[model samples]
Target: MPSYTCSTCEREFSHCASLQNHVKVHDNAVVDRALQKISEER
Candidate 1:
C-alpha cells in the first residue's frame, strides 16, 4: 500500500485511492473559483 499525506485535511492515509477520493471532497470547484475571484479582486 502506498502512503499519502493530504494537504487539505492534513491526515495521513495508507492507500492512494482512498487518499485521492478524500482529497476530492476538499477540492470543490467553487473554492477554486473563489480563490481566483479573490486574486482578481486584489
Candidate 2:
C-alpha cells in the first residue's frame, strides 16, 4: 500500500486527500502564528 507523508511533520496518511487536508492545517497554523507576531509587533 502507498502512503502519503508530511514533509513538515513526518506524519503518514493513507490517502492523498487526507494528506492535503493535513498540510492545510499546518499552513493555517503558520498563518495564524504570523498574524499573531504582527499583532504583537504593533
Candidate with the greatest TM-score versus the true structure? 2
Q: What is the C-alpha lDDT of each candidate?
A: 0.85, 0.96
Q: Write the per-residue lDDT of candidate 1 for residues 1-42, one digit (tens) a residue.
A: 567999876898998888888888787866989999999999
User: Model 2, 1-42: lDDT tens per residue?
Assistant: 899999999999999999998999899999999999999999
TM-score of each: 0.54, 0.92
Please give the lDDT score for candidate 1.
0.85
Model 2's TM-score against the true structure: 0.92
Looking at model 1, which ten-residue stretch has the lowest summed lDDT? 21-30
Best by lDDT: 2
Superposition error at 21 for model 1 (Å) = 0.4
Which pairs of residues have clashing backbones in candidate 1?
Answer: none
What does the lDDT read for residue 20 in candidate 2? 95
